[model samples]
Target: MAKYGVHQLRGIIGDFSRVTHFPNANLTVVHNQSKRLNQSQDLSHIAVALLVSTLMQERFVWMTAKTNGTTYRSKIVRSMEEAFAYIDDYRKTFDTVEEP
Candidate 1:
């Protein structure tokens, strides 16, 4: 049995969502949020190239952490920041407008 690390979880999520449409699963991380049953699966345009693995145990650590590349990581970070900005704008417009 192959044990997958936390970093690979995003791809796993995307893969799983392609086949199964579970209602309770939070597939947002992979941009596979369940939508209208009659429509086709929605693919989020978000760029998800970086894999930030979750920490499981101290004993099982990667001997040599393999990276796709620093440039890719930077791109991921930039895209994430862009997403945050969009979220902030949406919240300001719809969520916080009525706050006194």
Candidate 2:
């Protein structure tokens, strides 16, 4: 039920990539809309580095980054729906906890 604030990256690619964070959900999503096959290692490195620095409990990168062979701890997904499903599942983990 948490709303997400999106941070879009411009001029980096045709479709560009969007980073959205849902603080209340403890989720961070990177939606890579670019179709470009060749993404530089540096860019992937920087993206992963940023994700690693975040305190969010869950991180997801959708689209092209998976094909680029960049190693990251964030879950690589194929679509926004899948990402949302993952977040939903994650939230269920907390639902089992009883309130103090």
Candidate 3:
């Protein structure tokens, strides 16, 4: 059996979303509350990329931690930022216009 580290917790990273990894599963992070296919896909492009990255890490099958690489680790950073931005935009959207 193989164990994945914190880096393994990240999957696809992109302009829209990120895929978060846990000990036993994956989480797709998206922007906005929309769950429609087109909207979700728009929001989850980054999520998909992160998932693909994770899958690539696993090589679409399985891998031991000893084989993980630093290059792979660097791949997911922007995706997390994008996911945060995606959601942050939504947060701002709900706020009313203020006289500030």
- What lDDT does each candidate get? 0.27, 0.33, 0.31
List model 3 lDDT by residue over 17-79, tens digit each. 233343333322221121333342332212222222354444322232112222322232234
Error of 1 at 55 (Å): 32
TM-score of each: 0.24, 0.27, 0.22
C-alpha-based local distance difference test score of model 3: 0.31
Q: What are the per-model C-alpha RMSD values against the true structure?
A: 15.8, 15.8, 14.8
By lDDT, the best candidate is: 2
Residue 14 accuracy (lDDT) in model 1? 15
- Which residue pairs collide in model 1, if any? 6-53, 7-53
Give the winner by TM-score: 1 or 2: 2
Q: Is candidate 1 or candidate 3 better by TM-score?
A: 1
Candidate 2 lDDT for residue 37: 26
Provide the lowest-lDDT 10-residue window in model 2.
7-16
Where model 3 places Cα greater than 4 Å from the true spot, the runs are 1-78, 97-100
